[model samples]
Target: MVTLRIATFNLENFDEVPPNVRPSLAERVAVMRPQIERLQADVLCLQEVHGQERPGQPRALLALAELLAGTKQAAANVVTTSGPNGEVFDQRNLVLVTSLPVMARAQLLNTLVAAPMYQILTANPPAPQPMPILLERPILHVELDLQGVPLHVIVVHLKSKLPTNIPGQKVDDFTWRSADAVAEGAFISSMKRMSQAVEVRRLVDSILDQDPAGRIVVAGDFNATSDEVPLVAIRGDVEETGNGALAGRVLVPVENTIPEPARYSLFHHGKGQMLDHILVTRNMLAHYRGSEIHNEVLHDESGAFATDVKYPESDHAPVVATFEFA
Candidate 1:
């Protein structure tokens, strides 16, 4: 019986910014030490990582590892994957582990992201931007050998659709119009998000259509609610399609992770929303029978995240699960 633990976190602004007006690298590392250590996860997934340079997220993984240096087995390595924040020269994906012998020999399983599905977000604007054009958001896939059997894992972050109504924004008043601008492509920025989510589903379907027996875990900030459209569409469970299979839910049945009063990754209309998520294919879901979102983050004892006490953890918590290799 081989047990593999999987977890995903939106490490709130976890980056090595300027390094001037910030906590020492050492302090930052210490803050995360408890979380990573508590997880004792064999494989970890992270998003919202920032760095100064090529797919280099803010060395948060390194910092956290450093904080847990002596304890982490001597066989761990960092695998960096590029994300959408390349232009911001910030936030990237970092995969860390205590041990995975197959890692040294495991090849990228299914990363044939179509070229046409290019990213739509650009950190740098032609007239007023300084970042790169959106590429597809990074999703890390690796097939690990657990007790001689191979298991696949995928980590991802989907497009966000929060801060819904911005003034001066060319959003159509859906109630007033036959269809809102978002549905009709009113704001290129907002529409791009919907496009990204669709692309993810397309890619996932393409992958599973080829390997229905494959195990896949799709997790990250979706920015859409369990009752939202894009997600409903992914599962084809929306009233319109009446046919999707994907299921999304907060690990704990009670105690909402998306708290009120500016909870979630960002604030919109003075309300909090959950953009972070974890999704599993029907096959994989069966194996990963149970999971939870560790919303208890310690980003700060005060400030935008002061309300957290009973649950002190990342603003965007870590969603994790343990599974039996079937």
Candidate 2:
């Protein structure tokens, strides 16, 4: 039997800024590198990693490369989601790093599910036509060979609960002009989030249809808790689906294995929440050894105090899970 450790972390807008920036690359690396090293993961899924670009050069993960420098993962195989132009996005790119051999890799954004068209009820002028609720980021899918063991991993960074900006909706960036605008903007955001969730669920089902016992893991910052709609949609719980035959396809949250008090990965308004997750198929549960959330030093990032302070470390903690596959 061989043991594998998987970890997911949201670096929280990890990128290079000007020299005068509050949190320099060195400062972030000092805090983040140790957190990553602690995981000792064979496979790592990262979200919110921004790409840096220079004139006459393609966008690259320079900040990420610097953070992984001299580390085990620095030399590992890396795969990242790119745009239609076949280039990595300038911001919030999903990245997967692994020491194991990568067998296949792909990305999905509105591929399995078509984006729904909706007319903004709060459009500045009279609305003309509906617009597609496009995804801001794509899901990174990779198939790895753990020696002879096949492992399927999907990394995603779903849309945040922050309301999508609608024309004439906001007085400023954070301030809304009225409650109606806030509600409508939030509704549109929810639609996009739910659509992405359905697409992920469809991809999970497609894999299971081909191989029921597929060893699969979906990991990242879902931007929602386990009891939320996105999690519910992807988990496909037997109780919710009312089908025992589909139980094998159900994905279980690894964070659930941790104690209630220690299960959270992020703190908001002083309350702990599990936004980051490592979900595994039920068949992999037998090999599941344990799980951990390195949140002992996590801080709340909800109020003015959080905004005033430049926390070197990411607000979200790194979550790791272990499995022994024979």
Candidate 3:
């Protein structure tokens, strides 16, 4: 049996900014290099990666490839598909692989449903209200041949839960804006995230339709809790009806393999949260061995950010999963 280890990490806008910034390129690479080395994954799914402007331009991903040049996990190929537009803000998804060859690759952006600018409200005073909007992010899909086993990997950075106010409307525009209005904004964000999750589920269905026992792995920064609607939608939890005719075959969250207290991948406002996740299809789960969340690399001995860590590596940690295949 051959064992393959895979990991998902958000580099936090790597190689796109100028060196004059708080955390210079050198500073980020210094910490990121060791972290990647420690991960030692056969294939790595990276989010928030900076893409190349033109076909033949110098890419930030190449710089990252250089960082891993002499490492044991040196990638033979670094793959990143073009986003909807040519490299906007250098935000994109990237895949780095060592020995396994990427048989095929694609970017998924148009499959997700887009939310309209406004929705109709039925109330005492009906108004054309604004709903949470969905802005598509490029999802990196790559098919890799792991020891002759076809493995489909999808890398995603779903819509965040940040409150987005309507156009020409600020959060504090009016001192007395109703609490309902504020709550509406929050609901919109959640809706956007849920839409992305549904799209991912659709993608999974498409793959399974062709091959019932397809090997698939979905990994990324979900930006929502495991029990949240967004995650639940991706997991495809269908309540069992006595008939057992329409049961959904959903992906399993690999975090469950680890201990509860140590599963968190990020700390915000002093609260530890598991924002990063690695979920695999039922077919792939049969070979699943174990998983880990590498948070120690982001902090020092005293659980503080590493020295000269202006950026602190990333707000989130890397999650890795291992599987055995023949």
Candidate 4:
């Protein structure tokens, strides 16, 4: 059995820039390097990495990987792409850094459609500003050979509280028969994205459909709570989400790999919110022995090893899970 530590984190504002703050990439990398090294994840998925807006800025992700590899003695093999949208604020989707070599690589696997009513409406008291076009977030997939055996991995960062409604008025808020119409419309849009979530489910099932015993793992920074929406969506029932599915039925939450809320990857305004997760199949969990969402590396005050130097590294903590692979 081979134990592998895997993790995912928002790495909040990897390129956060204050209006007056000069773009200081090295300082940011300097703060995060140690925490990243301490996790020592065999597979690490990241969010919010920024790059050249006008082809002149430095590459933050690779440079950090270089710094980590150089300073902390980490040799992370890394792969990443810019955001799917042409104007994604120079922010990228996912940077999958791993020591384990990947078998297959794919990106932007799916997208959700908006409620039709939203498309037909015009902004009430129309804003002097241009409207926002609704966009579905991207999902990244990579396959790796874990100890000579194959494993499929999918990484996703879904949409935030972004409503699918047009500006000034909810589709129903401004139109005729708007009450139930608006509520139902918004719910339907939610269901659409949720359906997109199920698409990944079916995609996984399709893979296991051909190879019933195939080993697969889905890891990401899903914005929803495990029980609230995302995890339960794929887990088959509207109830609890699980670690595996086999023979066409969604399996129970075996191995209980993902921990409770206290084990979260992000904090906001002093409150802890766990938005990162790792869901594995029974085939993989059979070898799974350890799992924990690590925050010790944050280097924040009130935490074990607090330091202002490390405090500015990132707002989100890293969630890690360990399992033996064979």
* lDDT of the candidates, in the order given: 0.50, 0.90, 0.71, 0.61
Q: Which stretches of model 4 miss by more than 4 angstroms?
A: 16-23, 53-63, 71-74, 82-89, 109-122, 125-134, 162-165, 168-196, 237-261, 268-271, 296-311
Error of 2 at 57 (Å): 1.9
Q: Alpha-carbon error at 189 in model 2, in Å? A: 0.8
Number of the predicted model whose lDDT against the real structure is largest = 2
Q: Where does candidate 3 stray beyond 4 Å?
A: 52-63, 84-89, 92-98, 112-117, 120-132, 171-182, 238-248, 297-311
Q: Write the per-residue lDDT of candidate 4 for residues 205-276, one digit (tens) a residue.
A: 777867777777777666666675756776565234343333333532332545454565665545666667
How many residue pairs in model 4 have overlapping backbones? Answer: 1
Q: Which 10-residue span in candidate 2 carries the lowest summed lDDT?
A: 301-310
lDDT-sorted candidate list, best first: 2, 3, 4, 1
Tell me how far the alpha carbon of residue 203 in candidate 3 is from the true structure, in angstroms, after superposition.
0.4
RMSD of 3: 4.6
> Candidate 1: where are CA atoms >4 Å away?
17-20, 52-68, 71-74, 83-90, 94-98, 101-136, 146-150, 162-186, 237-272, 297-313
Best by TM-score: 2
lDDT string, candidate 1, 1-326, tens digits: 66767666666555544556455555555666666666667767667665544354432344344544754532465545643442332455535343665443221212343233322222112124222224345555555656664445555565444323322333255332223423322343344455555555665666566666655555566667655665655544334444344332112211133344423443344445555555665565555646655544324333454553322335665656777764
Off by over 4 Å in 2: none
Lowest lDDT sum, 10 consecutive residues, model 3, at: 239-248
